[model samples]
Target: MKTLTSLLLPLFFFAASAASAAPTANSILGASDAIRNPGGAFSVTVTLTEFQAGKQVDASTLTSYSRTQSNGQFASLVQFVLPARDAGKLMLKNGNDMWFYDPLSKASVRLSPQQRLLGQASNGDVATVNLAKDYTAVLSGEEEVQNGERQLRKAHKLALTAANPDVTYASIEMWVDAENNRPIKARFFADSSRLLKTAYYRRYQPQLGAERPTETVIIDGLDPKSVTIMRFSDYAARSIPDTWMQRDFLPRFQPE
Candidate 1:
C-alpha cells in the first residue's frame, strides 16, 4: 500500500505541473491587456513627445475616453487638447471603424489605424485597445527580454495575427512578463512582415483598479534614431454615453 501511494503521489504532482504550464494564449494576452488598461470605461490623458536623432522635435497632448463594447473590443473617443492648432479636433473609433473630425473645417474623414499621429505614434496608439479580442495569439516561446527599464525579465513571447482586416497591425510579436503577465515590449509588423515600430511598456503605477503601465517608448524600426515617448496620466473611471462615440456628435461635443 505504501509503494502504491508513493507512485500515485508522483503522478499527481506531474499532472498538476503540466496543467499549470499550458495556459491559453488568449488568456495570457488578456491578462497583459488588463495591465495596460482598466477593464471598465475610463479616461486617460496621453502626452506624446517626438524625438529625431536624439533631439526633441515636437509634442502634443490628447484625452481619450474609452469603453468596452459587447464584442469585447474597445470604442474610444479621443479629443485633441493641446497645441492650439489641433485643439477641438477629435478622433472616434467604434468597432472596426475609425474617423477623424476637425472642428475648423467641420469635416469628418476616415482614418486608418496605421496613420501616423506623431513620430512613431499612430492613430491607434492613443486609443485603448483590447488586443485579445482583435487578434489571435499563439505562444511562440519563453525567453528573457529587456524591459523598458533595461532590466531583463523572463517573458512569454506571443505571435499575434489579426483576426480581421481592421486591426492596426497585420501581426505583432509581444513579450509579456511570465510571472505577472505585465506587457514588457512588442514589435509591430506590417502585412509584408516589415517591422514598423518597437514599443516598450514601463513605469507602472497604480491606476483605476490595477497596476498599469504609465509610459511607453516607441522606436522607429527603419530609423533607429527616431523615438517617441507616450506618457499616460490622470486615469479615472467615468460613465461614457453612447452618443459621445457617434461621428455627428463630435461637432457638438463639449469638454468638461
Candidate 2:
C-alpha cells in the first residue's frame, strides 16, 4: 500500500461519498464464469521496494484486507523506510480516509472525510485493484488462455471509467473470464501515453467455496522514485471480523 497508487489519489481528490451503489461480485469478476470466492473474504502479505531514477532506494511490507465482491471497501497498511527520514506507516480506507502514523513521534494524522480529498479514491483508480462504484464498465473482447493444464476463458479488455468527462485515466483495461466475469488482469493509464501502473492477479486457488487472487503484483510509475515493485504473500480468503480493524490499531504498531 506504500506504492504510488495509495498516495496518488487521496493527495489529489477527496474520497467518494456514500450513497452511490457499488458493483456486485458477479459484475466485478468481469465475466459470468469468472472465478470468485463465495462470501467475499480475503487477506494478503506483500513486500515493497523503492527506487530512485531506477535505482533501489527502500523496501517494506504491505498488509491488506478486503471483501471479495465489494468495491471501495478494502483496507491497506504500509511500512516505509528511508536512508534519511525516519520510518513511517500509512493506512488507507475505501471511504476516502487515510491515516499517517509516524514512528518518531508515536503520533498520527487522521484526515477528515471533508479534508480527505483525492480524485482517484472512488473508482479504485489510484490503487492497484480498482473497486469503485461509478465507473462505466465495458466488455471489449476475449481470448483463449491456458494455465498449466487448465484452459480458462479470459475476458479481454473489460474497461471501466468514471462518468465525469474530465478525468485523468481515460480507461482501465482488464482481462476477465467470459463465463464467470471475474478479472484476471488489469491495467491503469494516463491518457494513451503514460502507463502508470499494472496489477497481476495470480496463484488463484479455492478458499472456503470460491476462487480468489491470493497473490498480487503492483508496478510503479515514472515519478516518486524510491519503490520499484510491490507484491503480496500469505494470501487467504475467509471471513474477517470488523472488530479486528479498529481505527486505533495504529497505536499498537507504534515503535516504543
Q: Pick the candidate with the highest TM-score.
A: 1
Residue pairs in candidate 1 whose N, alpha carbon or C atoms collide under 3 angstroms: none
Instruction: Give the per-residue lDDT digits (tens) of candidate 2, residues 25-140.
Output: 33654332234323345655555554566766555555555543245434444444332353455454433455566766777776432221121122232223333443577655
CA RMSD of all predictions: 2.0, 15.7
What are the lDDT scores of the predictions, listed in order? Answer: 0.93, 0.49
Compared with the true structure, the alpha-carbon lDDT of candidate 1 equals 0.93
TM-score of 2: 0.54
Steric collisions counted per model: 0, 28
